[model samples]
Target chain A: MSEEKRTDLESLGEFGTIDLLTKNFLITRESTAFGIGDDAAVLERNEEQYTLVSTDMLVEGVHFNLMYVPFKHLGYKSVAVNVSDIAAMNGTPEQITVSIAVSNRFPLEALEELYDGIRLACQHYKVDLVGGDTTSSRSGLVISVTAIGVVDKSKVVYRSGAGTNDLLVVSGDLGAAYVGLQVLEREKSVFQANPDIQPDLDGKDYIIQRQLKPEARMDVIAYLKELEVVPTSMIDVSDGLASEILHLCKSSKKGAMVYNAKLPIDSLTSTTALDFNLDPVTCVLNGGEDYELLFTVSQNDFDKIKGNPHMTIIGYMTDASDGIYLVDKNESLIPLSAQGWDHFQQ
Target chain B: MSEEKRTDLESLGEFGTIDLLTKNFLITRESTAFGIGDDAAVLERNEEQYTLVSTDMLVEGVHFNLMYVPFKHLGYKSVAVNVSDIAAMNGTPEQITVSIAVSNRFPLEALEELYDGIRLACQHYKVDLVGGDTTSSRSGLVISVTAIGVVDKSKVVYRSGAGTNDLLVVSGDLGAAYVGLQVLEREKSVFQANPDIQPDLDGKDYIIQRQLKPEARMDVIAYLKELEVVPTSMIDVSDGLASEILHLCKSSKKGAMVYNAKLPIDSLTSTTALDFNLDPVTCVLNGGEDYELLFTVSQNDFDKIKGNPHMTIIGYMTDASDGIYLVDKNESLIPLSAQGWDHFQQ
Candidate 1:
């Protein structure tokens, strides 16, 4: 290899490589309203309706560990993660196409277990498995899913549409999935040391389930519809609250101040985080794989959701000059930093 | 993770996993006309147009050898292969979505080089970049791209639509890409053995180019449009001609008789195959990644394409009882086997 041509990926990081890969991409079709910058791409077919499409690829060894992970939950979470993208756009997922590449190392029964979870998730989410491609892989299993959905042109929400005064609300609690992973890893290590030991997973069940079989939050979409709520901007917190909130802030051209007191931490997640020697608040900010929707609501609809059992008003949008900040219980304003899924850190 | 729940991916192979994963997958919406069983999945929207969507994932080490393959060609080929799937359905090139997961091993500039080729392909095919996800991988780079294109409801063809008495035709030539790959691999081996020897690629440019940068036959879509001809069935020859023909047969409930002499072979591919002591016909039959279009036309339209220079009428579709046969140069009938890119065999 040429000395100058020896390129390393770490130097680019995640966003840097992404920017490099897509810089020259041109939107040629008139139907493509938006492309790479948003959570989900927007395509318009007519004046009345628009189509939303997004895709995600999960590589074995990179995304999961088969040793401790169930194929069934893997299947469910696979669909849920992609579906969460659609839910973030305030769109109902109509169809999904799954493509899988596997080596001969998997068994028919094992695959049956995987698909059973897929079928179960399909039944749960009301998504159709319309089409997919099946091919052999040289290494571990890879699942790539593309979801297609539609919404009225006027109702489709994007990450860039948030206004300055919009309230930032997150459905469900944060840090649960992160805490769940801590428990799973702790048990796994203990079990590894002593094969005869049984896992002591009592109160951490919710967090464990959050990490294992999280739902797409389509219920939130339906609930929002019934409540006549349309988020000014929306995003799913797959990569933690801080990173997601930053996305909303960057795209919406606004800043936010989320109160630490207002942050929802499930009892189980908080206790588990404490057990792991981690700060629960920091876990909420930096923890990922929550699959919860974080969205902005106008002040006009505040009263309608203020009493809701499923929603929590974590903060409100602020002027760009104020910057993204978090007011802790000490009444100190601290700048929010996104430490979500830094896959490129040395 | 339980001791009782040990499952390996290789036990299922590729097809078994697919069947297991999509066994219960259903099409709930009217727009999804076909699902899971064909080359490209089909979707219908609005009145006169149907959208064809297909996705492919390429993982480093598994899909390509970065040692020999340039990153730029990898990006270009990624888009080309996905676009070929839309063309497989006799659809026009339109919009595509790309998702990539990279490790920390790459630099920002490297991604730019990759995207530069992607943008070139987009400009070449006139397909818009829609939306996709960019994330981190623990290992090699993984790229998953989904291309969506529109086809007139009447003109859109499926592999299952062919019938007895239809004529089978292919655009451009076969096996050139595969031969080109052979040449590149041979050169790489030599280069690895000793870097002092430069690549002996002189007079071997055409097949090498074909393998490195194969173009999807969008021109055939235009040609059929101009000729006012609609193919009864169509598919891209990505998995070699034999496998594609088998797919057409299995889907369309028919058999075929492909004349060996009529198979198109570029002069360069034939000579290169000879140099490698390989049968040119076999390379053309079982070689893959050509990205050429193969379709079955109605008997009535045969005369319309009788004098067309771009397309060659290689064979005719027949009853399933007739069996899939290859008429050798000696005029003897021989059963055709699909030795196309067997990941298991690889």
Candidate 2:
């Protein structure tokens, strides 16, 4: 018999793996307006509206560490992240189905605490917890959430819609969540060495909350709607700024030039990065899990959001020939690469 | 500080755990027609139709044993089970989002095999492969599928809609899948004891296929629709006949009396059960994973499906005060209990 070919999963990476697995699937449903290769799947709902569906999975040890993370926060973050996908499409989330697989080692109260956070997110987002499956696992906890949202057909944004010269904007700040995760990991190490030693999490509430209980940018979506500024293209910043920029550029068949000086990094995040011997700019570029919206708007609509404090105009889209680059503070153009978190590599 | 009390998850079981966790959640979305406590959640799609969404999670070790299960069959089974939920609601599945988490120990080829099965199932069910998340896990492979379906508002069925004196009907033969699992388990034990010994699966093809690749009874739904028979209440036979009957009774506020002699058990399944020193009737009552449609029809519509070959009239619904029981072959009445598979207790 001929030897079967074997390839490591690390070689394909996450995106490559997904593409390889799903490339052969043909979309045959008329209701499916868009299938795969986007923030969420778009389904035709009505003449004026579209339904959006997105799914996310978080595996224990790979996605979160329970040593420093509370169950409630984990639950809240799981829902928030899936909601962020809907927000990326500029849609209003209506319902979510959360499926969790947990080992018997976890007590009933632990799951209850998790659901308490889920309930809070449902209340905050005004989304219904429609249905889900709860099953037992042999190892760690696994949470998979699917969010369904709706948007006007004319207003829905996709990553492949960016036009050349369109302004690239991002909501809120960046790098806080990643920096906060570092602090938690450090504390975990200290507590592991000496169980009696208390974690010194004083004055790090902002960063810690950014990591544990990050909110989806539904507020930004609402603000955009109020301003009547529909983005040409959009994606959520779950896998670092550089990675998201690359995704938008690749999907839109365009290039981008983002200014390092224009990147939004909270002062606390900057100082925390420096304290950990890391550069704030690097963290803002490559650190992930911010759950902020990164999008592009036409130059004509720039005047509406020009001085908006909630959003930052980081750069503009360029011709595809011009490779994606970051204009550093020193006036040097640095090629951007996605050093986003790859759980497989870890 | 006083020690916090911990409750074992085994005490709640699967259904109890979900109920306890979701009891406090209030539905706030205007689009939510019905939330939880059904085969699928119902959402308002349009004036004429209702959208249905259901999710299921399969964890390795708990849901399937890789030693005996082919990755392709596992993938196919996962999608089929989720589609079964849609069928249970008397809906047509249109789209599905499949999220998977796998350890690096699995090769890229393994995932391809898995997705091939997913693709095949998508083609079979005519469900579009939409969006999903792919991530890494610390241990075994996990597959989570969310199926999106649509049904006419007037034809939609729910577990809580059955009326007293409604005819209880079931599609396909019961306990075959469970018996197939036993045969596979026996072969696995034999293989483990002596590596050189080949599996004695010569004449067990039908039963083995039932266990590995059970199909959702969408055909039955189509037939019912063609016959103008709308079920009053419906549920997929996933957790055995007794458990499903109990769910229907609890949801509909009714009771049932199932006849053991009337259960549609195939000859092969019966012979296999006898070989394993098991009662075929007992397996039919408590053995799960049949993926058959168990539904109730009004007495007026019984004539339409009276001589149908695909369906069997197992029993009928009764008043809530009548209690649920099983009439054995000896004509003795016995109260039925849910001995369906419990992963937590295992």
Candidate 3:
């Protein structure tokens, strides 16, 4: 074979390929007031409102293992994860295009179970299941979903909007999803070794469910509106809490001082981390796929939302010179790094 | 596996899965004015326009063979084919999200050449290259692209809007893409058996190019406006001429007649089909991925377009009782069937 005949996808890497593909794009339609360059692609729907569009692709074996991943939970979590992206933009999801590429190895019943969870998510989140393509795959299943949502123009948030002193807050708990993954992996190994052994998952249900069926915090978005609190910046918890925090910080050209003690982690998540011989604090810092909403609000609105039960202020934004750091329980500062999963590495 | 677990995707079919998945989807958000059943998903954007969202998945082996298909042509065709879908709704594409899962057999330089073609398309189409996911695939390469486009409130066309007596027109010529496929396959066989034999493709460039790098008929869409003609209904020629005609017929609740003599076939396409000993008519009717626009215009504008190049008025709409029929050169009546490539069958 000629040496010139072979090419690798990784030389482009994640960032380079995106830059190459999008460099020629010019926004033409008036309706497309904005395209790309953000957490979600923004569109003008009305004089007062904007539509946000985001898409994600999840492939089996690469993204999930069917050995421990139920088809129903997989479906529900896929929808929820995409919905969380829209939520990070402070947009209410309206419609979703859920396209799945399946191999013939999957049974009709398996697909039905997957769709059942999809339908359940549509009902819970109030997003319509719009149009999608179903095709055969030569390998494991591939699910790609494009979610569309509308938001009042002024209320839309971007990760780049964080400012000095803006209180960084995340809704619900963290690290549970990552801990749950460890639990599932352990159980899968045990089951493989001895098929007769049932999964010893009694106290780990909360963390496991969080990983399997995480919910998008659309309710928190609505609540912020009722309290009349507009976030200065926002992002969703997907690639672990630390990586998401770093994204917001880097995009905003600022730094963050996250309080490790204030991290909202479920008791079960903490327990399971210890039971699995993992550090609970590390789980809270880098455990991923929580699908929770992370945002920053002005200190003035703090009085109003501080009374609310769902909000947890985990950190504060800092000037770029301050650098992003975690305030450990010992009061020592540690610079953050993104240990998030990179599919390219797989 | 048990018999119950052996039900394949083909057994469920396209409509079956769609019916099952969308059964319980209740429209929750007001912004989701419409969902599921439409040809293109309707997303309300500006006060005067709507954004059309659609997605398609192309997998290696299932969609194309790397041996016969060049990466550059594959990239261009991918974007063009997607843009054609937006054009089908009388909308201009504004943005796209390209998600690809590739195996390691491909190198970084090969991906660069592929993106080089994608960038060229983005320049030609004037659409932004937006956010997308890149991951490793276990087998072959999988590309899922979601295209977004916009239309004027009054100008946007749908599959359901064709009226009785509407004239059916198809842009450019047909059968060439399929004939081109045959030529490429034959050449592939030649090369496989005798490594030293040069491919005899001197006069078959047009057919091969048509097969490899088919252009989406955005020109027809632009010309229609200049001619003061608005198609009452339209669809792109992705799933063959016959399947598209059937879509218009089914959506309009009307039958149709297509005169085979009126079917346009380029000279090179005809020559290539003869070389392959394939029926020209069969190629035109059943060939997929033409990416040409097939639309229905009002009868009042037929005379204005009669002399124009790049289009052929192949058929006319009639009452449902009339049924869909095609007249052959020998004056034989043949019932039309959507023998377009069924992905399920593959």
Candidate 4:
């Protein structure tokens, strides 16, 4: 037999594989304003409006485990994460289509509960549930959602628009979701070891909620619009602060410096990290699924966002040669590395 | 323990479940022109055009078996099916987002080959590959594609617009894909029983291609536009001719009469059906995944479609009281029953 070259997928990773595959795309439609390199694709739907489109997939064992996660929350999260992509574009999500593949092990009532969560999320986000396909599966359940949103042509923001010296801002705190995951893992282990043990989740409500029912920060986007501030570049913090910041930097051809002292970490998140014997700062930087907005604004708009309670200016963009780094509380500079989740990695 | 109420999904079936779940959707957006009832959802993008969106999911082992299906063909089929939905709406497909969940057992080259087919489909359809998510799965593979299309507000056709006496027309022949699937399944069994036996597949190219790489009828759509004939109602024939006609009838509150002699069946499909001891007429009526266009044109436009080599006028719409029926060569009327695919049914 002739030896054919076979490369493992783990070596290329998710981001690398996507970049490789999409580099050959030829845009053929005049309405396609932007394609394949952002949180969402932008299409020129009219003279005044640009539409944003994005999709996300959640697999049973890869993205969630039903043993600890309720089906309703899984349904809500599938919608929320896709809505987050629209929020990252500074656009208001208007419609979504959800497709699912389920095994027969799930009953009709289980799906009803899941759709209840989806209905609640649609109501909360004010997005219409437009169309989708449902089919049976051989393995576990899979859910894929595609969201569409619209923004005025002038208000659309992209990750590539950030310029050097722009101020970096973030909405809400980070790391709580990761801490909550750790807590859930611990409880699962305890239950597996002894069925009599009840989960000790009394004081961990904040972190646990962060993990299970994360919200897309549409309120922050509305607040920014109310304050008359349009960010130069924006992205949702789904893959941790460090990875998202790097994404903005790579696309904008700039670097960033995040001060350690300014990184927002909730008290519950910090306490949970300590309990897990993990560094709280590491958790804040690399913990994922926060669903916050990480954005860069022109230095001129600093005053508008400076004192906003929902937002904090964490850092500033720098020349590309300077590289991405974290300035510690002791005024020491350390280079940042992406420790975000990569599902392709073993 | 007190007994809790539960319903089986199989009892409701796929269509019944979707209707039950989506019945309560409150469409708050003025831009939402159509939701959840047609081939694709329609949204008013501007004053001049309506945007169409649709999604479909294919699960491994459930939708296609890898033993007989090539990865590239699978990817091509996945994109083609979604594109067909836009064509069903009489819209020009503009862009698509393809989300995939794959197990790591697949090498990087497998995905590269799959993307090659996806890229080719995009080129052939003149649609842009916009954006999507890629992640790992515990299951074999799951592909979900969302296609976006556009049509002039005045020209968009819906499933609910058919009237009594409209002429029923279909593009190309039926039952070829199902015959192709049977060929592949037979070849698979032969190969499984003997290691050294080379299965014969010569002269079966048409049927095999129909199964592995079905094309969406965008050409027919374009041709109809050139003829200045807009179908009163349209739906792509994915779930067999009988089922699609039933969907149109149910949606339009009408009935239809199909003639057995007028039903277009390819020679290879008929011969293969005979070889498999299956009725050729049943194959044409109940076999799915043809990806042909089934539409209704006004009686006044009957002269426009009479002699088109690419189309066949097989039937006509009738009042709801007449019921859907098939007329045999002997002029005997038989009630048409939908025996099309139901993935949820065992």
Q: Considering every candidate listed, which one attains the maximal DockQ?
A: 2
| RMSD score of candidate 4 (Å) | 1.4
Task: Encode model 4's per-residue lDDT on A1-346: one tens digit a residue.
Answer: 1129677778888898788877888998999999988999999888989999999999988888887888789889989999999999999999999998988878878887788889989999999999998889988999999999999999999999898999999999999998999999899999999989999999999999999999999999999999999999999999888999999999999999999999989998998899899998898788889999999999999888888889999999999999999999889999998878888984
lDDT of 3 by residue, B163-232 (tens): 7888889999998888888877888899999979888778888878888898878889899988988889
Docking class of 1: medium
Badly placed stretches (over 4 Å) of model 2 are A1-3, B1-3
lDDT string for model 1 (B1-346, tens) is 2346644545544555566567666777776788787667777667787777788877777678787778789889999999888887888768888777776566655666677778888999998887776666666677888888777787778888998989999998889989999988999999999999999989987888888888888888889989998999988898789988998998899999999999999998998899899999999899998888899999999888987988999999999999999999999999988878755446
Per-residue error at A133 for model 1, in Å? 3.1
lDDT of each: 0.83, 0.94, 0.82, 0.92
Candidate 2, residues B28-140: lDDT per residue as tens digits? 88899999999999999999999999999999988899989998999999999999999999999999999999999899998888998898899999999999988999999
Residue A25 C-alpha lDDT in model 3 = 55
* Tens digit of per-residue lDDT, candidate 1, span A61-102: 667777678999998888899889989989877778777776
Better of 2 and 3 by DockQ: 2
iRMS for all predictions? 3.2, 1.9, 3.0, 2.2
- DockQ, candidate 4, comes to 0.70
lDDT of 1 at A157: 90
Q: Give the TM-score of each candidate.
A: 0.95, 0.99, 0.95, 0.99
TM-score of chain A of each: 0.96, 0.98, 0.94, 0.98
Poorest 10 consecutive residues by lDDT, candidate 4 chain B: B1-10
Which docking class does model 3 fall in? medium
